[model samples]
Target: MKGAPRMPQDDADAPRFARRVGILVTGIVAVSFWIVTLLGALAVVTRFVRTIVVPRAKRTEPVRVRDVDLARGEIEFDADGDSRTPGRYSFWFDDDEGHARVGDITGGGAVTVTRRIIGVDFGDLRGVSRGRLGSWFHLAPGEFGHPYSDVTIETERGPAPAWLIPAAEPTDRWVVMVHGWGGRRPECLRAVETFHRAGYTCLIVSYRNDGEAPDSADGRYGLGDTEWRDVESALLFAGEHGAGGVVLAGWSMGGAISLQTVLRSGHAASVTGIVLDSPAVDWHDILAFQGTLNRLPEPITRTVVRTLGNGWGRTISGLATPIDFARLDVLGQADRLRVPIHILHSRDDGFVPHNGSARLAALRPDIVSYDEWGVARHARLWNYDSDRWDRSVSGWLTGLEG
Candidate 1:
């Protein structure tokens, strides 16, 4: 009694059951794969967001000082991309107790490059073994033959320190100089002489979380979304100090902040012009360029950008408020610009790509004067060629006066 005669139904049920089980197993594997992929993407997004919002710790010493020849007025440093770059730069050592300016590369070997010492502002370079290189070649306003007073701008976050360098002649025309991300007021000192000669009082300002300024509630960078507010306070300070007309000069992230202030500030009517050096006009473009430079996947970049703009990403980015990237897009809102803009961007800008500035200039050629340069790194246009930089700025300011 072999159970019963061979039943077609039973045979069919066996195959059907096997097929159903196979389908279930495949579904589980596919779900698991997607879940893993999603988790990985989330991790990438979180890290990218943190990088944008978090303030990096100040580097104690990034460049190794190989030697310093006082008689030759030259300094030797371990050769790297920044040290080898053709331009003048500053070095701070002993926790900024020592400062020195180094100029055009004189010579180099396999691992070290020697540069002419422009001057040692305060520190004796002889005993220094390591230091940090910077683009702020001029350490103070006095270096440019102008007396400066340390002032404070009362910002929403708190009082932020600023350098108020009066013009050689009594004048109501003023220029508020904003340094880039992770930059200090000293970086703006390089442009003080040019603006001062043009009879514009220079106010070099520090914004929130820039180390010198008070930290924000979250202590995170807004990528210009929130930093612009601090700059607005600087504009108000200028107006109170008898600024009949003002020009906003900014570098790198400072450029982005200046743009936002022009668009959002109540005192914008007082602003006559804007000067942007290696400006990050579009955050999206900047972030995308940065991602590419760091070899991040396109998907990760897109997700990180999305995270920065939405509510859900606030926790991940440590942002008190979700950034409205659309508002930060100067190119998209070019028509709203009321003041003339002079953009000095280098074709070889390694940090902020020049395409955004180029597009903006092309779109608004009538109001935007683009002075494209060659071989200048980001925010170091003046360091590369001070004469050219000064001439361009002076000429532009003259036109603004007219």
Candidate 2:
């Protein structure tokens, strides 16, 4: 090796080779890092999708009942955001065996709050330790003084339970009410009396994957995609039962389902108007807002949305059919809406953002009557101010009649 006198070229080649190796090693490490990051993001997105599609079987009771003074018409609860929030709320205890209405925070401390108990609908509240607070103040239509009959609407999945409350004065107009995500027929009972007073028969329906309705094949929520079909069946039932004109009233995700029903159903011609409360106008918007609320990274939210929209993601999302987000976007297709829409959304909605509703109202003011509220939480506008809710809805119904 020493036979050749040290050449300049040979020394130059040594550094060049070292540089190539360095570049190659750095490239490999960067690629590996990206791969690991992608895998972690995918894992997070999978869990998020599961929660969105999977139906929850049990309701969580986070409000603890510290004491119940029935004689004094008062109830004390361990103070929390929901328990301390103003306005009336329903308390369900012992697997929903007991239900009571609590109104107005009478007194409050750092760790406890006592509310005036309006009345106990059922079950003894004496020894109840804990319960769930909700907006379902009325358990059934009868609670609001309307006689209702249990009827079944035959859907593609099976018979779905519904509450049929006929109008006191005979009228062919019907208002088919749909509840929000994970809600039952009782959630729609608050709006029944108003519709009944306006001479509209109220039909509160339960769609598939909701506890009251028959389960779909996948036992998952379609997030208004497939659930709309069940609502279509309800519309057909209403049409068969002499519904001359129909109004579709929905809350939260139910609004999404109602939007889809009107756009996709053959029976859409029968729908003369729509009423929405705290609606999920766009699933993409809702999911993005939720992702941000949960502190998820932006890329993770985008990837989750892409996965939900692609066929290859079915394995991860557990969806039988890849969701078509473009089709579910009501804002994108506002021009297609023919019926009058009355949207009542609260600025303080914690669950679903009201911006989409505001945008929709701005876009289609001709057909949309947006009644914006200041303090009502999601789907609880009636609970917050029943007089205003009734006036708005009744006025809207009167406009439709005129």
As a whole number from 0 to 100, the lDDT of residue 275 in candidate 2 is 99
* Best lDDT among the predictions, by candidate number: 2
lDDT per residue as tens, model 2, 268-324: 999999999999997888899989989998888898889888999889988888888
For 1-402, candidate 1 gives per-residue lDDT tens digits of 343333346766777667666787898899999999999888878887887889887556988988989999998999986788877888889888888888889999779999999888786787789998888887766666668789999999889999898988899999999999878888888888788888888899999989999999999999899999999999899989899998999999999999999999988999999999999997888899989998899988998988889989887998888889889988899999989999999988988999999999999999999999988888988988999999999999889888
Stretches of model 1 off by over 4 angstroms after superposition: 1-40, 60-66, 94-97, 109-111, 122-130
Task: Supply the global lDDT for candidate 1.
Answer: 0.89
Give the winner by TM-score.
Answer: 2
TM-score of each: 0.88, 0.88
Positional deviation of residue 201's Cα in model 1 after best superposition, in angstroms = 1.0
Which clashing pairs does model 2 show?
none
Q: On a 0 to 1 TM-score scale, where does candidate 2 land against the true structure?
A: 0.88
